[model samples]
Target: MHSDVPILLINLDRSKQRLQSATEQLNQWRLPFTRISAVDGKSLDENTVKRVFDEDNARCRYPYDLTIGEIGCYLSHVKCWQYIVDHKLDFAVILEDDLCLNADTPKVLDQLRKITTEWDYIKLASPYKFRPYHIVEQLTQSNPTISLVRYRQKIPSGTVAQVISYRGAQRLLQQRPPFFRPIDVDIQWQHELTLDTFGLLPYIADNADAPSEIQQLATRKALKQRRWVKLKELLRFKLKI
Candidate 1:
């Protein structure tokens, strides 16, 4: 069903090993997909950085300043969403460079095709650690397999693996340039996207064991310290005495 849907893999130009792994895995499944070259933040000029971090629009609401790698990652996703819109694909599967998929993936994908109309987006990979959900309906009653869910307490995170409909792509395309948040967090905004989102249990796709190039550096730790600086500024703004 979704077998024909275009699949796009986002990989950095320098990450050859990761690209090799992703390509090999797709070969095994005989899944046709396009590999996109990610934007290299290290190459960005001062003007671009200022634009991405504009003070006026409050781009990137993260507690910490976004690392160059993180910025690059976000831009890569934006490129993919734009590709979806440009190609006018009704639905497409977007996968990050590193992911582990089980044999059940094909089966789950087939099930997904059966229920595509029920959702605009479905997370085949469990991006969030935990999120509360109520079973909207069962895909096959036989097993907890593909099921429609209404996430009560959380929105999906992690750009590991997911299916996006054309409408979903349009919603994402609207949020262009100087992003206000990381790609995953921004996508979770249901009001912004206005789409039905669901998830799969016992994920067919999970992040791979390979090291994360984006966060492999001290990205998170630096962000943590940056958070303190931002917090102090916020306190000063609030205290009117």
Candidate 2:
């Protein structure tokens, strides 16, 4: 049953090539999926923007103003979460369009279906390098190679691929909207989202490393770095006193 789990593929309307790549990969695995027309930050309607995004909150909470591309990407994931709730699905696999599937993915996904661990969210792909994590449960009695784990120190980032339960979807949606952080960052702040999150080891998908469709200007990058500098200076001053 991995095939039983619904897969939601987030693809922008203009990213036909990415859509094609994802479709081919899923077809190869014989895993069916539904395509979500991603929210395009380039041309957001005023009303929809007002309804979904909170600029003031984002500016206050996040280090820098979010690029429209980041906002659109976050909204795209939100669409998948909403789908899980509306359909009353028990669980769903959400995949971005730019992931390369591993041959072991299907087998790992099937084992995940049989595991007994109580989980709200599980990451299938992590952007960060390996960090300390404790194994939570062995996926199968026979194969000791794959297991579920909880991060001990640093939480991994990226929304490349993940599994979300119906309860998880509900908790995420419960956020009193006008969401502030990027989707990945918001998920990492489980203290706020309040979900029992975990990661599947070893990762079953990798980024395709294509030129990102989400565009951020140089100014935005510099602004984020500048915030870190200020924080570092504050830390230094505290150390002196």
Candidate 3:
């Protein structure tokens, strides 16, 4: 019942099933959320693409140009950041539709509000495989243990769940249009934006088993490639030329 910041849920309009599933999960935790209509890759217009995405930068930094789905996903998070700035919110917990929340999530979020330190961004989830983390300190001495952790080597993958402050949102937004990296990758490289990033230990949110829309779209496209394309790849690998 004690939440200092609004919870923003990013969901695509076409993903009714994901929205419903995420809704039920949040309700179970008694957490009210504002829905953010996720941007769909398939519907992106030329103007938006040119205005928001930087093809040259993307090719320079990433191995491949970002897919339509990646571009849409990046824009969706940008919308949430814009919302925080426009609405004048102090902070917000942004959740992707595929994230799963546990019982301790609400309490941890409450504890986050009480902390007086200069933390800007706090991650609430990580990939299934565990990674080495530097624990800065525990949130409280009370039950439902959770701690603030700093990443020494790698920032966790996926923007499935995270808490961002007004300042943090503004800093991220300052990067502005013509974004190159994927949203998650962009967050991992947050140092370039001068963000004090951290993650929560005993992560409260996890990725659900539901298939990823982006990956599915990528796979389908790959399957539809010409046979010659597959033959060329196979020949290159076998011949080792």
Candidate 4:
């Protein structure tokens, strides 16, 4: 029900079923959000695709040819960033359509807002656990909750949920279009983007059970690697979150 920090849901118009389900979940929580139509990579012009490919600089990036869905997802989030800049908002919570938010989501967001101005970005829904994150601060001792964490050179997880400020949007847009790497990887290049980023502990959110549009076109080999990465992330999940 907090409206101070605008909530934006990145969604593809084609994913009507998912959108409906996502909408229902959000509505049930009585949380307000804006749904931004995701950029459809399949319909992107050749030149548009070339530009993103030109900007690709991901370390251990996507192995196969970038799928239209992946590209679309990237463009869609960038679009949300642009919206933040355009509206001049204090910050915005960008949630992917397949997002799961529990009752504590509001509390987590409230604690996040306390430090929103201190950071350019904060990952809210991390699928797999990651480590070596320099803990910047802790908000709750009883629950072992972290207020902030430095990624240094690693990203915690997917773009399922995160909060980014207006300045963060500006820094992220510097990467420009035709970004070769995945959106998740692009935001972690702190040295490159100079984004003051952090991740929350015990992800208060996760994705809903649904097929991922981005992975629909992935090759068998790529899928294997993806699973391996997930397994590693799962280990992180067991870290007493």
Question: Which digits, one per residue and each the tens of the lDDT, describe model 4 over residues 1-241?
Answer: 3557688988777889878877888787777889998887678898877767653432134443556677888888888999999999888989988877876776677676566337888888777566466778777665546467776557775788998889899888876675765677556555567777888765667877765663234532354344554455445434512
**Alpha-carbon error at 94 in model 3, in Å?**
0.2
Candidate 3 residue lDDT tens string, 4-38 = 56999999888889999999998988889999998
lDDT (Cα, tens digit) per residue for candidate 1, span 61-178: 3455567676777778778888988998877788888887776666566665566345667777764477778877667655536676677755567878888877877876675666
Candidate 1 lDDT at 238 equals 46
For this target, which candidate reaches the highest TM-score against the unseen true structure? 2
**Candidate 3: clashing pairs of residues:** none
Task: Report, for every candidate in turn, its global Cα lDDT versus the true structure.
Answer: 0.70, 0.78, 0.78, 0.72
Off by over 4 Å in 2: 141-144, 214-241
Clashes of 4: 4
lDDT of 2 at 85: 95
Q: List the residue pairs that clash in candidate 4.
A: 51-178, 52-178, 52-179, 56-180
What's model 4's lDDT at 163? 85
Give residue 16's lDDT in candidate 3 (0 to 100). Answer: 89
The better candidate by TM-score, 1 or 3, is: 3
- TM-score computed on alpha carbons, candidate 4: 0.81
TM-score of each candidate structure, all chains considered together = 0.82, 0.87, 0.86, 0.81
Q: Which is superior by TM-score, 1 or 2? A: 2
